[model samples]
Target: MKVLIVGGAARLGPHVIRALEGEHTLRVTDIVPVETQHEFQQVDIASPAEVHGAAEGIDAIVNCSVEREGRRRAAFDVNSRGCYNMMRAAVSHGISRVINTGPHFTIQGNTYTTFDYEINPDVPPHPSTNPYALSKGVGQEICKVFTENHDVHVLTYLFYEFRDHNNPTLRGDHPFAISWRDAAEAIRLGLEVDLATLPSRCEAFNIHADLPHQRFSNEKNKRLLGFTPQDRLEAMWQRR
Candidate 1:
């Protein structure tokens, strides 16, 4: 299958590119050009022309771009509007599936002062607290709109506690810490699943690896995509 990864030159995007490149035809794109071994394209996802151009003949798209600011304007443009542009392009070109990333901060209303709240994929999303979370919330809404209006299969994953490969300090002890490899696999799993059989109109899952204090239940992912992480941070630390 052919896949277009937006912001593919970014840190986590590179990891996802590597994981998918071996098995699928990959077209990597970013707002700015970067050196990479994969097929690269330069396109601003915020522009409909660029998105439509880049999405031509692609099978799927992974919405990985995030523009974070203290306010909602820029973030909304990139996260929400940018995602709409990509979905429009994908549908126009006959793409079948789209996988989008939503941030854990969307659950801020559930755990404002503490990080101890348990999460489940089926739980209703609470109110967003900040601009970043608001953008993600809007993005998820856009995904649903595409699915309902366009008849496109869209899956969203609430990515939590993203691990920074180059910076150990950025790694958290939270139970939602998904390994880079596992996160990539989750995308692959979501991409392969048949959406027509799903019982719901829209599907969202919490992307997390096994943690002793896991706040979110991954049962939905398992039931829908048979997705389960192959590695855990505790096991990696034990090896060290």
Candidate 2:
């Protein structure tokens, strides 16, 4: 498959590229230049023309773009408008599958934060007025709308904390954390899953390691995308 990765210069981009390389042809794009062996395109996803142009001849798109902090306008432009451009490009290019990524708080906001266990992705989004979470929630909604109206199928992967699998440091005991390797693997699965097997045109999955806290659930990810996170991150919870 030929894949287009938007925001390919960001933190998560390299891990995703490493996971998909050699198996699929990749066209990596970012607002800045990306030094990669695969096809590179300088794309500012906020611009529909640039996004559409970068998507040409691509079989699928993985949107790793995010604007976590900046002025409110800039945040909305990149997180919200960028997602709109991505879906529009997918529609124009006749692409059916897109893997969109964002923080898990897009779904698990203030309301759900009080709860302790089995919080699933299907719950209503609360986002709690935090600019980053709100913008990202809007982006996920855009992807959902596009899937509902078009032939596209969008798989949204929501994550929380990310740890390095090699060194495996436990910065905090956040129940919703996953190793970078595990996160990348989940994206790979999302990209390859058969659209026909999905329960809806738009589905969101919470991606994380199998932590013992039981605060969040990954059962949907396992059942649908066949994602079984390899990193248990036992050091975070276990006593030496």
Candidate 3:
């Protein structure tokens, strides 16, 4: 399969890139290029003109861009409207799937709220009242709308705390923790699944590692995608 990863130059992007490498033909696009090896295309996803231009020959698109700090509008623009733009382009390009990266807080409470909660794809969203969290929640809904109304295949992965790539560590016992490797595997499996039986023509899954205390449930994802992540926090810690 040919995969296109948008905002592929960011911190979390490399993990997905590494996992998909050699298994699929990969194309990368971002506003800037951190390295020069991959096929880099500079694109502003918020711009319809740019998205349409870059949607050519792409089988699927993975959104990995996060907004800059203090740029709430840009955050919504890219994370929310930008997602719609991707789906629009996907339809135009006859893309098979649209894999959208979602925040763990799409299920968890906001920073101001003390309610610690876990979510399954079956459960509805209950986000803490924060702008970022709200935006992500809306982003999930946006993908759902695109799938239902447009018959597009949209897959969402709710990832919580991501570990450092270079020198990884587990600060505390957080149930929402997901290693980069595990996150990548969840995405790969989601991409590999047969989407014909999905209820909404769109699917969403909770993406996380096998932690001692799971803030979010993985039963639905496991049943649907047959994903059992190979890495664990303790093992990763021992290796470190």
Top candidate by TM-score: 2
Model 1, C-alpha of 104: deviation from truth (Å): 2.0
Can you list the residue pairs that collide in candidate 3? 110-128
C-alpha lDDT of candidate 3 relative to the true structure: 0.74
* lDDT (tens digit, per residue) of candidate 3 on 1-240: 888888887666888888888688878888775574667788888888788778788887888876645578977887777887888888888886888887766655554125444456656567655667777777778788877777579888877677754455445666666778788877777677887856667777777777666456777777888988666666443444
Q: Give all candidates' CA lDDT scores.
A: 0.77, 0.91, 0.74
Tell me the deviation in Å of residue 146 in model 3. Answer: 0.8
TM-score of every model versus the real structure:
0.88, 0.97, 0.88
lDDT by residue (1-240, candidate 2, tens digit) is 999999898889999999999789999999999999999999998999999999999999999998988578878898999999999999999999999999988878878878647999999877757789889999999999999899999999999888987774554688899999999999898888889999999999999999998999999999999999998988787876
On residues 1-240, what C-alpha lDDT tens digit does candidate 1 reach at each position? 999999886556877887887889988999999677877889888899999999988988987888767766888888888888988887899887888886766543455326545567655666367778877787777778788877688777777666644444443466667778788889887777887878765778878877776566777787888998765666433433
The ten-residue window of minimal lDDT in model 1 covers 163-172
Q: In terms of lDDT, which candidate is strongest?
A: 2
Root-mean-square deviation per candidate: 2.9, 1.0, 2.9
